[model samples]
Target chain A: MDVDIDKIPKHLLRFEYPIFEFNKAIIDATHQYVVAYKPNMAFYEANGLKGWKSLEKTIKYLNKNYPEVFTIADAKRGDIGNTSSMYAKAFLKDLDFDSITVAPYMGKDSVEPFLNFEDKFTILLALTSNEGAFDFQTLSTQDSPLYKKVLETSKTWNYAHRLMYVVGATKAEYFKEIRSIVPNNFLLVPGVGAQGGSLQEVCKYGLNKDIGLLINSSRGIIYASSESDFSEKAAVEAKKLQLEMKQILENHF
Target chain B: MDVDIDKIPKHLLRFEYPIFEFNKAIIDATHQYVVAYKPNMAFYEANGLKGWKSLEKTIKYLNKNYPEVFTIADAKRGDIGNTSSMYAKAFLKDLDFDSITVAPYMGKDSVEPFLNFEDKFTILLALTSNEGAFDFQTLSTQDSPLYKKVLETSKTWNYAHRLMYVVGATKAEYFKEIRSIVPNNFLLVPGVGAQGGSLQEVCKYGLNKDIGLLINSSRGIIYASSESDFSEKAAVEAKKLQLEMKQILENHF
Candidate 1:
């Protein structure tokens, strides 16, 4: 589940309820069905310091209430060595996210720092769902596309076992090529519903023995309805995805 | 001037002074010689909410006192369309930075949102100063290296005029090649002093009609001393770089 704070309904925002309140409502409605709750850091950050405070509150609420539910900070952050170390501390240690989405633009040093934290995952951007994914990610090198090189090179980093890759559901066909590169690593697949990607198509080529795929649908699930019964409407959408996931798991495993 | 807050004197941290105090002293000492002061977001973010508050205070101080100093939030942040828009608002609107660094891996949508803001610059990561830069940035394609493609493709985006590229000082030899691709655009060059990159080499190929380069030296200037007179020591180091920049301008322009 992806929680974009700004996209929450006007009814909630008009009442001046804290952003965390809306998040809490969503968590209450969906935690039982969710394996992880990925919050896009940019959305919280856009609102300034108060938004950050809301994020802190939301994370604390999750830890206290649903400790089993994984939290991914969808912050595509990477920098040089020392700077990357600081970002690792920010998201992993301070905010205590299970993992973070990182851009693989800067190579090993930028990534290795995040991998240093034991048990915390570093979800590197392999092939994103955005139209810009075509810009540089798919550029053909002598050996392979740039995204494949990212996967192959990052596998050599320290704590390579803790690494996962972001492979968009939009490009489900690419999963066959992607899986061939890193067969065992889990794939966080976004763009499933609203982006017009099929869950069945993603599972066909991307699934491994470990059932290594996290299919995400943000707008489709969250904005299913804008009425006062938003949480209940959200629950219906969540249940639908959960059922689809369950069926995929049973058949494949 | 790049302020790595944690690198401030042990006495300051020991006394539990807010990080802004250290930044204020640094700014007071070096603002005259400095064309800009960049605070790496990761450093402030590592300390959590209080750190973000200090970041706000630091930027406010720079804007109010040293209005001439261009402030770059050394935040290499980018995401999808809506998410990228949020990040644009976070740095360009909410925090009100003159510019923020963006990783171009996700392509146009990730970068274009920041460009939408008038008078604000989007410093795209073209070729960074880290060893990991060798991993993908320098990878050759049919036409050119990936970094050159980024420069060429990003030039076609909306508000491309507001864009600046990060061409590392460590690879001063690549400057001539880089300048040929984007002759008019400014390059924000890091890695000059502490990273052993020569300013003269960077200037030899990078200087344009506008003297278009912002060469950065963080550790070399800020960590010149750890004693009570640390800020004074920083001023002397900054003055050396300022003098060097003056000479380069006079000789080249």
Candidate 2:
């Protein structure tokens, strides 16, 4: 969903609440430059259920406002089969999001339920931005970090074509290594801007031929200005990233 | 909350809204055994915004009807400082949960905001029940898995005395391993019966003299019967676990 910054209500500015203001403003300023909007569900959820209500309203507003924009719920959810089915029902059925971010730690049964949906996508947590990313994600079992094995194993899930991955911008250094493993699939890049991630380095290796990157800039854009001009500043910040992304898309196209 | 399992409202019996019914019934049965009832915030959330409302009601119900039960919003939340403050507002102010579960992955700044609450507890995710647990939890970084460092570091937080740890039921093998590290703190354990975790094993290694284990049996007890008999069965299941716990406490005292 392209969250047009100008369309947001002023009272909704919050870091905890990754509001439609961020999504709308960013989309208003940059949707033409990018293919998807990945609103990390945690950002809105951290605001309590009210923030979630805002998110639902935001997504509905987007569907009505920008039918062309793809909606990705950056939820990072994955669980046992029955649980995943319920999750899929929650986000895909009730919320009507186009995609969801998932954690593939529980293997097939946990992730497959999300994949069962026809067009909705599941972006699995591959390599994160934190220092602890090195803890379990990069730990070597047979010569490859466990993240690689996750990518390799994920390929076997039948309905996995709708799958994508989360490769943090902070780990842009490993994008080249990651792309070599799963070259064709889309990647949702987070940890850009306010998180100290370099957009230039991330595009260099993470971008696939489809201009395949949904780079999420949460705090940097949404919480750009805590004051009344927050939405406008978010547009400015989003435009900056979009301009850089436009050049990256040009090279591939 | 008094998880009103004994006489569940008819609508929620078919695992339709299991957390609601299960929580209610369990509370009715085990409120005496626990000072706190922590339904993993993730479980309710996995159901999306509507599920979030149920959580709100659950917390409200506990505060209204069973005020003695300290409600823990088990979100396993940990983020940057300002973000953490907003989260504090989300749960403490918005949801009004008496406690919360935090992730200690980030360090002091990530956990401190939650600890600032005088009445609220922040139960850190120290040791989990998942198989991937060995991937990081047991890593010999300087001394032990990051969990040990969490337990030690948390000791210095001003209200860290209110802190707890999520030690899994399956990790009872590390009973002696854990006892040596933390002798007094409460452990919120999942992975009982339904998850192939043994109650005997968990108590063997995990029970402190204070009966410091809020061992949650969600699926096993709640889903024990899909019919209207669910609550009755849930009460039966909870009583069985509580009885065993009573014996364990008897031996300890």
Candidate 3:
């Protein structure tokens, strides 16, 4: 689940507390139903240093309370080799995220440093849920689509085992073709609820032997209601997805 | 110039001081020979909250002491519509950067929020100087290259006047083709000096009526020496580039 802090509902904001308070409520309510907590860095960063403090607190809260839940920094960060190393340290080392989202635009050297970390994962943006995914991701060469090229080329890099790719749930039809290219790797699927993607349709083509999928629902679960029952509403929304996921696991396994 | 803070020499590191102290000396030494200072955010963020504090201090130092010099937050950030708006605030509003480098992979909504700011510039990644540039940037359709498509499509976005493009110094030959597409916009050219790109070649094909180029040399200038004379050495390097730029301006103008 991606926690976009700014999108917290009005009832939650009425407490006149820091953003972490809202995050705490959400985590307390929904942690049982989630395998991971993914927080997009931009939302916290937008508020400046104060925002970062909240992010640090939120991550600490997750680690201290729910040690079993994996934490992801959905920063979408990548640069050159040395620079990428710095980002790797920032998220994987300093912030203690299990994984960080990266853009594949810069290629091999840009991503290599992130993979160098021992146990940490690097999730490359394969096919995003937004309209912009059509811009360069779907563009074709003489051989294959650009997204396919990303998968093929990245597999050749060092520490390829730590690699995962993001495939939007909205692009469920492409999952069959995507699975043909990367059959073993996990796919972090976004856009299931708010973006109108069907969980059932995504699972039909995306599942692998490892039951590889981390379906994220941000706005749908985190911003479920604007009233005082926001956390309860969020829990209900997450439970619905969790139950669906449990059913899918049983069917596939 | 993109200041990758970790690249500062061993001599400067001997001080056992905060990173901003080294940056202060570098800026004091080289400010006269430069028009702008671009700090790559990953370098600072990698060190965690303390590193970000150094970044905040560095930017404040530049703005306080040298108001004439433009500052670019070379953080290649972009996301969906609402998320991008947060990044715009993080860099342009909270951090007070004069400009920011953005990735065009997400298309309009991801970039439009950055451009929405008045008087701030948004430099889109068109052609980067790294090996990863070949991964997706060069993929061509029947009409033009993906980078070209980015230039054409982004030109139609809101606040297009605030836009610029990153044309790597390594791809001097492509500048001719790129300039034809975006003739008037400034190009932030990296890969000069230490990256083995010829400043002369880039200016030959990239310059416009405004001498529209910000040729960046990061390692070549900042890590010019590993002794106490580091600041003076950096000044010498920056002066050399400035003189060459002046000669290029004289010949072209």
Candidate 4:
């Protein structure tokens, strides 16, 4: 779910909503191999009102045409209690997304409102896949690193079962430790391809009996090409990753 | 700059864009007392595309009519490197806001992109005015709390001068400790009116020779009344706060 006016195929410019058209092409081509479509909100938001409309169309298309596929609004949002409720309602109820990414910087009250929605999931940032991730996330608390405390403390909240952690693919070594804290909960792992994180490394320690991992690849798949066959190229990239995951599952199971 | 369809005057609903119309009335009434208008993104986003349009109108109204006043897109947005850059461009460049609030859970790389803008400010969340703030912010690190570390570490980043912090007015006791670390940088202090924080307490320790403190009162002022004269009532609330602040400044000076 990454589209930029400059980066999208020039041919798409003729459409009323090029971003939505590009997304529809990619979704139509790759829906069979993918279980979830995580649209990074920043990309759509950068375009303003048009960007927002494109996002609304993309989500509606998925919900209507491909109900089986999960939808994640990669809008990293969290705030005070009432404010968080508004965000929860916006993303989960209004947008009708299955889940939305959230930052845990504001703590429990900021996050719990999102958990109130029955089937909706809240993906909390634990250990992000970026160089700056080490800044505060990895800071040593009294006994353990801050990320560990986040994983440990969040488990005690209401509707904890609906909580999923965003454990970056870039930090595969931290998977074993993260799994110990959040063994059963699903993990949304980003940074697989473009960020140089090994898919095998993430699967080795990330997989559980439920196959609890939603490995995400943004730039690697969606931006695979910018030509007329952009969606086909995206599908090929998605298929390759899907095949790798299948192989890894066979070896694990 | 908070406007809600349910909370605004019933008569405003007759307008095409009630939220924007309501905001315009409030700004028209209270602009003299205010130096900045901070619109919480959740309210606008909850209404979808129409909500977004209202937000664009509200900001445009402020930029055009009250150019002397600062505009803040209170969108607590932060993501991985490139994604953060997209957000920075959205709020700071595309929306033409003077500043945007950011959550720092992802750390320096997530925040630096927002700071990259020449004159636009980045208000990083440090100690938010909420009960959940205690969850991670107050955690004891090796020597100082996580928030102090946030204040201490963030100062070392590029364009640190462009950085201000969201230090909740709820915990006025922490202001002295916070001032010691970042003495000169302005602190956008929320939780003043509705959340019950003392303007006197915040000004005592949080003030610098530059008088660097932006005290915020949201619900107490904006929702002052839901009747026909809602904006007039809101002006009264805003005036009261301004008077209190004026007295504090007089005594401090």
Candidate 5:
């Protein structure tokens, strides 16, 4: 769950750590309906040290109370070899998140370091949900689009089994082509709800025999209300999406 | 300087904050020779909250003591629109670094927010130093290599004037081609020294009318010695690169 302090309920602002409190309330309200709780690092890092503290508290709360629930650190970080290794250790080992999103611009060595962690998953950005995804991701290469090349090339790296791909819900049409390359891998689809992507459209082509799709809708559910009953409202929104996914899963099976 | 606790002198480790102390000594010795001091976020992040506190102290020290020198947060970060903006604010505004290195895979909107900040430069990754750079960067695109396309396409971005490119010093042959595309922009050239890149070769083609290059040698200089005189040894190494650059500049202009 991504928490923006500005959008948080006014009453919660009086607490010593509002972000952490808001996150706790949301998790308590919606944990039963969701399998994973992904916190985008940007929102936390933007607030500097306090933001980081909230992140630490939130993750600790999850591991302690909801140990079975998966957690994702949606930090699209990638760098050169040694640098990447440090980041891998920081998030996956130190912070102890189950997965962290990474960018593929630096290629093999930059990403493989993250995969070295035993059970940790590295979600690599294949096709993003933003307008900018059209900028370089879909560029015509000799054999296929650049995103396709990323998927193809990355599959050969060491510890490839630990990797997952981020395919935007907005680009549902591309899911068929993406699944053709890496059908078994779990796809973190993030552009649904607020980003204007249809849940039905993404699930139609994104699902595999393993039900390999993690459809994410950050703002749509988390920021469902700005009043004192924000967490309850968020749970309502989360329940709606959960019911939709439940129906999709039952029908698919 | 990249401060690795394991590589630091045993004596400094006793200090309350070894990373900050090591950075201060290194800056005191080498500040006169270097135009910029870049601390890769990975190094600071690996240590967790204490690491972040050390980074904050280091940056604050630089801004106060050596205000003229440029500081780079070598965090090759990029993401969707709103997310990228948060990173931009955290590093450029909140943390107040002069510049940051960003990955270009996410495209225009992901990068444009960084450029929106006046006087702050956004260094976009083009040709990286790592072996994995060949994975997608050198792919045969419709017109040119992927890195070249990155350089060409990024040049037309919203605040194009604020953009810089990262062309690894290891790939010196590509510098002439890179310079042709970004003649006026500064290129953050890493891979010299320990990474096996030759400064003279990178300068041969990478230099433009503005002498556009920020040659970086992190490990080679920072970890010069593991003994108590580490900072002194670091100064000697920094001096060697500075003298070499001085001679090259005198010969060229």
Candidate 6:
């Protein structure tokens, strides 16, 4: 099992409240524990235009201030070819994140455009945690789960090596089965913390030799405390997770 | 059947584009022939902070200037509950789009979040044109195709009455089958112009009693003329389609 997303980008795009102070406190508190940070696009987007601007500032600040940390645009974007290229230009070129999460529904062409950049990565949706997941991803076709097929077919791509998959942390058990097919690719696991996924279980099945896991706990960490100490609380929560992850990694490696 | 979505906000949440020129040209040219304008979120999003702002401007301009036109934020966004709420707020609340293209792999809670909005609409991915669409969407579950079940189960939601589905124009034959199940609900048809889908055939089986179809031609219209005459050429192309659609509507109605 590998970490979901191996190479994080420079910009951490999300809605960190109280902006500068919030990020500073969080960064100060738990910089050592976290390898990367992801700011969900909707959080900043909900705040309206000014919120979007703040997202930009947040990415720039972290890239300039803390180069050690990897940043991801937690934007699940995918589209047709020419439009996809435009998206590549937008997220990869203009905003300059290390990787962007994408939906794989449009097949390889839609996904490949994003994989063109040498350093950039593409995180494809695999087995998601939500109920609708049962509606399609888990459905069996040709004697295997659809997600298994998604993983298998994705490997056919030359740039599939640059691909990381999004496996909802809540569905950790599937990681063992998912690993049989997609052994080397990174997995970006969310749905931990506030979403109630078991981090221990995820590690049991999802970790690769490379320690390649990016488990995200958004609301649980970011909104840990609404007051001035919010980022500090976020740091505490992150530290706790990281500490546990370190033990898991040590035991396995 | 009905053109959904409310209005775009005044705030600059997305990227800025040459909205007036580009949109006006598309509107003027295709105003009579086309039924909808589907701008994939990635396009606006590619501009980073500026992209979302432009998305807002683009949506607002469409809603205000051309009430007859239908708009879609081809956001292909679907996630767990809390996150889906934020997505709904971002696209439907913050910006006005007639419909949002949602991925149905996540199940009810993920999709229902979008359905809660009145007048606003949700277009679930039933069958897409991509090659890998075969990997999951068409997979046989027991006896039914996954896309078939998606169309069936989505009906369980009361708000689903407001739901439309995405049936790729490329899969035009599926439209005949999809129409049998969802005879009344609208279908948001994409892949017509440049993704190698045909419009005449798509309309043959896809249209319903209300002309329940929103056929989108993005690159075919927007990038019609990359030169200064791009917008003018776009208008000419759009008008050609709209005129054809007008005849279709007249004959069908």
Give the best candidate by lDDT: 4
Error of 6 at A11 (Å): 25
Interface DockQ per candidate: 0.89, 0.23, 0.69, 0.92, 0.88, 0.52
TM-score of every model?
A: 0.97, 0.79, 0.94, 0.99, 0.99, 0.88
State residue A5's C-alpha deviation in candidate 6, in Å: 27
User: Fnat of candidate 6, please?
Assistant: 0.62
The most accurate candidate by DockQ is 4
- B237 Cα displacement, candidate 6 (Å): 2.1
- Every candidate's lDDT: 0.88, 0.70, 0.86, 0.94, 0.91, 0.74
At residue A216, candidate 5 shows an lDDT of 93
* Candidate 2, A1-253: lDDT as tens digits: 2232233455655544446555555566665545666655555665666568768877787678777888887655554465567678778877888988776545677678899999788888788776546645665544466677778878877787889988878988899988998888999887887678998898888877677788877666656665667656767877788888888777767
Q: Candidate 3 docking category? A: medium
Q: How would you encode candidate 1's per-residue C-alpha lDDT over A37-57 as one tens digit per residue?
A: 998888777767777888898
Which runs in model 1 stand beyond 4 Å of their true positions?
A: A1-6, A10-17, B1-6, B14-17
Q: Relative to the unseen true structure, what is the C-alpha lDDT of residue A165 in candidate 6, on a scale of 0 to 100?
A: 88
lDDT of 6 by residue, A72-142 (tens): 87767766666677778766777777888887766777788899988888888888877667766787776
**DockQ value of candidate 6:** 0.52
Task: Judge candidate 4 at residue A133 and give its lDDT.
Answer: 90
What is candidate 4's lDDT per residue for A1-253, written digit by digit as tens? 8677789999999999999999999999999899899999999989999999999999999999999999999999999988899999999999899999999989999999999999999999999999989999999999999999999999999999999999999999999999999999999999899898999999999999999999999888888998999999999999999999999999999
What TM-score does model 5 achieve against the real structure?
A: 0.99
- Candidate 5 local Cα displacement, residue B50, angstroms: 0.6
DockQ category of candidate 2 = acceptable
Model 5 residue A14 CA deviation (Å) reads 2.2
DockQ for candidate 1: 0.89
What residue pairs clash in candidate 1, if any at all? none
